[model samples]
Target: MKLQTLALFCAVSLLLFSGCGGISPKPSDETKIDKTLPIVKLTQNGVVEDMNSIAFEWNAITDERVKGIYVYKQRNNLEGSELRHYKTLENRFTTHFLDNDVIPNTSYTYSFKTFSKNAESQMSEMKIVSSLPVLQSVVWIKSIENMPRAAKIIWRPHANQKVKSYIIERKTLEEESWKRIATIDGRLNAEYIDTGLKDDYVYKYRVKVVTFDNITSTPSEIVQVVTKPLPNPVKHIVATTDLPRKIEINWEKSEAKDFARYHLYRSTSSNGSYELIAKLYNPTFTDIVEEDAKEYFYRVSVVEKNGLESIHNKISIQGITLMKPQTPSLLEAKLVNNKIEINWKNKDSRVVKYSVVKKSKTGWFDAKEEEFVDIKGLKFTDPEIGPNTTYYYKVYAIDAYGIKSKPSIEVQVKTPAGVRDNSKKEEITQDKPSRPVNKEVEVIVPTQDFN
Candidate 1:
C-alpha cells in the first residue's frame, strides 16, 4: 500500500468517529422500522480503479436502530452464493477492499446487509465494480536474437506488468511440443532475452504473467517470425529420383516478414560436413542429387536478402518430411514411326510434371525435363531419341513442395527405323479415335463472369 493510503485512512477514521463524541451508539434489541424492513441506502454503488484497491462507501443507516452490517463479495455477478459469506464491517458508511489482488478485466459484486435484534434490512442491491488492473501488453522486439544453432529471443516489456513477474514460452512449428523459455521474477523490469535454440531456425514465442493466488494471466498475442536473417531450414531435406539426376527439397517459410531467399545445403549424410548447395529463391531447390543410387539429406536455411544469417541457425534436418514423391503408375510406351509416345494414368496427383529420362553411357539423362513446366497433368510424345536405338525409359513425379520421388519402375521403349518398321504404329492406326458423346458435347461453356 502507498504511504498516502495509511494517512488517508487515519484522517477519515478520525473524522467519522469525531461526530459520535465519547459515547458509543447503543444497540436496541427491538428493530425500528415503520414497515417490515429497515431503510438502507448507498452513497456509491460502483467503483473503478487500477486493480489496486477500492474504498467502498455507503450511506449510514439511521432510525436509531441496527446493531451490525455484514459485507459480502461475489466473483460471478449472477449471484446467489457469495464467494465469501462474510467479514464483519467495522463501520456503517464505508469498508475498504484491496483490489490489487483481483484479476484485471473481471467484474466483482459486493453488498451489505445491516441487522438489528428483530429485523434485517433487505440486502442492499449488489454493487458491481470493475477494475482495469495493471495488466500488460506484450511487444515483440528484435526477434529470436540467437538463431538456429543458438535460438536467441528478445522482446520489450509488457506495459502493464510493472508490478508483476514475466515468463516466456516456445515451441517448434513442426510439432505440438511446447516448453518454457524462462521465468523472470519480481515485477519484471520490462525486457526479456531468450536463448539456447536446438533447431537451425527458431519459430514461436509467447509471454505470460502470474498474480494473486498464483493465477496466471492469459498469454500475450503470439509473435512468430524467423530469429535471424539467415537461411534457417538446413535440415530434413530429401533427394528425389523423379527428375532423375536432380533432387527436389522443400520447407515452410518463416511466419514473420522481412526475409528473402533460402539457402540450400547438401550433405552426403544426415549429420553435417555440408557444402552450400544453392541459394534458393523460394523454400524449394532442385539440384542433381549428387550421387546416384545413394541416399543423402538436405536442409534449407533462412537467409535475409541483406545477407545476414540468423545466428548460425538453419531449419533443422528434422524439419524435413520423409514421404517419398509418388511415381505415376500404369505406364504405356508405344512406338510410332521413329517417335515414342508415352502415356500413363496419373494415380498420383503429385505428378506436378513428368519427365522422360533416357539411359545412355553417361547414365540416365533427362530427355525433356527442362523443356516442360507445370506439365503435371499431361501425356508426352518424344521423337528426340535416335532411331534404331532402344532406350530405357523412366517417369518421375514432382510435388508443390519440390520434393521429388523415386523414378517410376523403369520401362523400355524402342523407336522403329521408319514408318513401316514401327509395328505399334500400324496396330494403333487400326483403331479409330473415340468421339465425344452428342449430349455431353452440347453443353454450353461460359467464359465470362455471371456479373
Candidate 2:
C-alpha cells in the first residue's frame, strides 16, 4: 500500500511540474492530427484596426483537463506557406488575444487549439485575416526655394487624428540615400525650416507621419528646392591710372533687385591677399595714396541685403597714380664776383617753371636756414650773399598741374673772405687812389654731389 502511495505521489508531482513551470513541447505534425484533445472554437471573426496589429476572440474553455491554448498562424499568400506556432495563452480564462506581429496589408491564416499535459487538440478551423494597410502620408506638401542658406517645407496636417508627429527627411541631388533631419511633435505643426544648408544647392525633401504607437507612415511626395545663390559680380569694372596721388575705380551699377552695396578690395600684387578698402552704395570709389606713381591691384564684388557676397572678379584690374615730372639736373653752381650763381637743365617737357633752394648756416651753433626762389628761367643768381659763408643748392621742376619733380643733386659753393661787392659804389678820398684796386679772390665750387 505504501509503494502504491509513493507511485501516485510521483505521478501527481510530474503532472504539476509539466503543467506549470516547464516549457510546453511544440506539437509535432503527427500530434497535430490527434483529435482526442478538446478544441477551442472562435466566438467571432478576427478584427484589424491598424497596419501592424490584429484582435482575436474565442470561446472560453469549460474542460477541466485543458491547460492552455496554442495560437498558430501562416502567411497564406506567400510561397511554401506553412502553419507556424505564433503565441500561447497560458491562462484558460483568456478568451481574447492581441496579435501585434502581423505585417501590414498581408493575409494570414490563424488556428487555435487546447493543450493539456499529455496531448494537444486538433487544430481549429483556419480563419483568413489581414491587417489594414499602412497609414498614408500628408496629402499636400510645398517647398519655398531661393531662401538664403536655408530651405522651408510646408505641408497640410494629417487628416487622421492618430498621427502624433511628423518625420522630415532630406537628400541632395547628388545623394542616393535620404537622411532624417527632424521630428516635429504635434499633428498641427505643419512647417519646418532647415537651416545651415549649402547655398545655391538643390535638395529633395519628403514628409512622413508618425503615429502615437511610433510606427512610421509612408513617405509623402518628393519636393525639390534650391537655396538662394550669391549676388552677381560687379560688371564693367574700370580703374584710372592718371589721377594724381589717387586711384579711381568705377563699375556698372548692379541691376539685381536685392543689391545692397558694393565692396572694393585692393592688393599690392595681382595674386596677393586682398584687403577690403571700401563699401559703398555708389559704383565709384577713390583711393588716396601717400605717394604718386603708385600702382595697385583691385577687385570688386556685389553684396546682397541678405549678407551674401558674390565671388571676387577672377581677373584683377591694375590701377596707378599719375607719374611725376622728371627731376631737374644741376649743371653748375659757383661763386663769381661776390655772388652765388646756380643753373639747371629741365629734362621733362611738362615742366613749366623752376625753383632754386639755397641752404646756408646762420651761425656756428644755429640751425641751417633754407630759402626758395621761383624762376621761369634755367639760371638763378643770389645777390644777398655773406662773405666766407658756404651755401648748398638744389633745383626742382614744376609742372602746369603743380606737381613737383624730385630735387636735383645738390651743389655747394663758398664766398671769398673780405670780398667787396661789385654792385656797391666805393667813395674815393684824397688818400686813396682813383685807379681801380684789384685783389686775388679764391672761389670754391663743389667737387662732389651732396646728395
Q: Write the per-residue lDDT of candidate 2 for residues 1-451, one digit (tens) a residue.
A: 9999999999999999878866655655565444766687877564544688888888788887777888999988799999889888887788898888878888888899888767788889888887888899999999999998999999999999889999999999789999999999999999999999888999999999999977789999999999999888878889999888899999889987798988899999999999998999999999998787899999999889998889995968999998888887666665554556676666588888877777775458643655454477777766566766677777888888677888888777766667555332432111121232354534444454333
Once superposed on the true structure, which residue ranges of model 2 sit more than 4 Å away at CA?
A: 1-25, 28-38, 361-367, 421-451
Each prediction's RMSD over C-alphas, in Å, is: 24.9, 7.1
Q: How accurate is candidate 1 locally (lDDT)?
A: 0.55
Clashing pairs in 2: none
Q: Using TM-score as the measure, which candidate wins? A: 2
CA displacement after TM-score superposition, residue 7 of candidate 1 (Å) = 48
Model 2, C-alpha of 29: deviation from truth (Å): 6.0
* Model 1 worst lDDT window (10 residues): 442-451
RMSD of 1: 24.9
